[model samples]
Target: MTTLAEEVLAGSRLALARLLTLIENEDPQGEAALDRLFPHSGRAHWIGVTGSPGAGKSSLVNRLAQAFRRPADGSPPRTVAIVAVDPSSPFTGGALLGDRVRMRDLSGDPGVFIRSMASRGALGGLARTTPAVVQALDSAGFDIILIETVGAGQSEVEIARLAHTVLVVEAPGMGDDIQAIKAGILEIADILVLNKADLPGAENALRTLRAMLELGRPPHEETAESLPVVWRPPLVPTIATQNEGIAELLGHIQAHAAYLRQSGGWQVRDRSRLQTQLEELLQTALLKRWRSSLPEGQYQQILTDLQARRISPYQALHSLLGEPPLPQSIQRGSTALFNA
Candidate 1:
């Protein structure tokens, strides 16, 4: 069979979609494809858009794409890739797939590629293979890639760890829901966007956010000695539906990207993300090997023994492995796999 990577490199839309599906399913082929493409990656600028449901993140992303369509002087027109994630309906295990509907105009543009992904109950607000898919798109020469989350609760913070710039969207009348966002989402935002800014209570919400940000700031260094530390982040307001303030938003994103690179934060963040990916792959492989090495018919007996209180689950697991779990420090070492 012709591989998805080959098709994607050849600019096949259907092949691109199939590759995304394979990665979403975490198929073994997906890993192989990623390995084949990794050398071609790192060219795209990744932007993550996330917030509460109904925050208009999809619209915001579409506007962002339009803004990024034309690259600066001497540079080629930018190609954008969008990954929109939606929660799967429990009854059917399928996403509503509504983001694409709002972005239909860009669908026909060869420069823009959009893919909708169902969360499929992946923890941390991303599909397990999302990073790999992003890498593929980056390698395929997309200049800008945007990730839109399902807008679930706090776990969506995971998006921050992936993107070079993160825009946290909010709308009017979220009320205490904004407070809920403060608990986790605030820290992750490189830019705070008040979407649906035309709505009632929008100004009030913006004022509240400003106050919250001010309150979160650290006291002046010269201030009369002892005070608690606080952190303040930049915020912006936008009506993404009307495309208002989008240019400014893009400017901020560019500025933030510059800041990350200048301050060395870009390399640090990228290294951390790569380390996390490596650890996850290693852990998955280790678990699979451990599971496959078990004697046939041994699983049921282990489960039964643990359930019946004949032995602790830990003890049963040890018996299955024929060894105790490796210590944390050793697991960080080169010999960890042999120990496992």
Candidate 2:
């Protein structure tokens, strides 16, 4: 069999899906594949779509894909990858796998690569290995990548750290939902998409958003002689299921991309994302090593002792590794345990 990396580089869809599965499972080979592919990444534009579960994020992403499918010239269409994250069953630990069902029409399209990932207990709305999967898609030459989160409340904020642009989707008659969104998602959104805008309360929602925009001051102030400018984010209304406003959404995305480039925020965002990813990788590796090196049954004993209050967590941790607590003087000179 061709190695997963070779097949992925050669644009084999099966290999791409299989590789994504391995990475999601955190297989050893997946780590090796990421190591091989990292140098080849950094080309694609990553867009993240997230909101409450009923906001139609998948439908919006599907429409966005349709809008971007055709290249400007008569040349072949640019490849696009969609990573749709779904909630896994608590009992079975398997995804409900509904994203693929929603996106069935685009599954067979050679120009679009769609993969549904199970959250698999990742604390944030994203999958634990989502960044790795995105890297694989990026290195595989996908021109654009869309990541859809599990729609799990505020934790979806993490998507902003990974995506170049984040679309926060909302719908009609969701005032409380919109308030909840403001707590976290609002800060991350590059664009706010009010989907299902044909509904009765859509206008009210739009007005609410506009009022919210007016409350916040712009990041920068204009000189006295200059025009008083508002840095209001683009709020676009869309009926995604009907394919209305998708073209405009694409235009907004392109415009934002241009803005990022011109404002120098693109490189800064990219660097910050890469740095966060590096730290996450280090954390994963350290946890794996720590888990593997622990003596059998030691963790269970620690837990039992913790519950009984016979041992404090700090003392138990030090005891498990046969280390004494360092003196304050020594601690100042030495690196922290996390660094160690």
Tell me model 1's lDDT, rounded to 2 decimals.
0.80
Regions of candidate 1 where Cα sits further than 4 Å from its true position: 1-7, 70-76, 177-182, 218-232, 309-340
**Model 2, 83-186: lDDT tens per residue?**
99898888888778787767766866889988888888886688888888998999999999999998886557889889988898988876653574355666
Model 1 lowest lDDT segment of ten: 222-231
Q: What TM-score would every model get versus the actual structure? A: 0.83, 0.85
Question: Candidate 1 residues 296-325, lDDT tens each?
Answer: 989999899989999877778778879876
Best by TM-score: 2
Q: Which 10 consecutive positions of candidate 2 have the poorest summed lDDT?
A: 223-232
What is candidate 2's local distance difference test score? 0.82
Query: Per-model C-alpha lDDT, please?
Result: 0.80, 0.82
Cα distance off (Å), candidate 2, residue 225: 19
RMSD of 1: 7.9
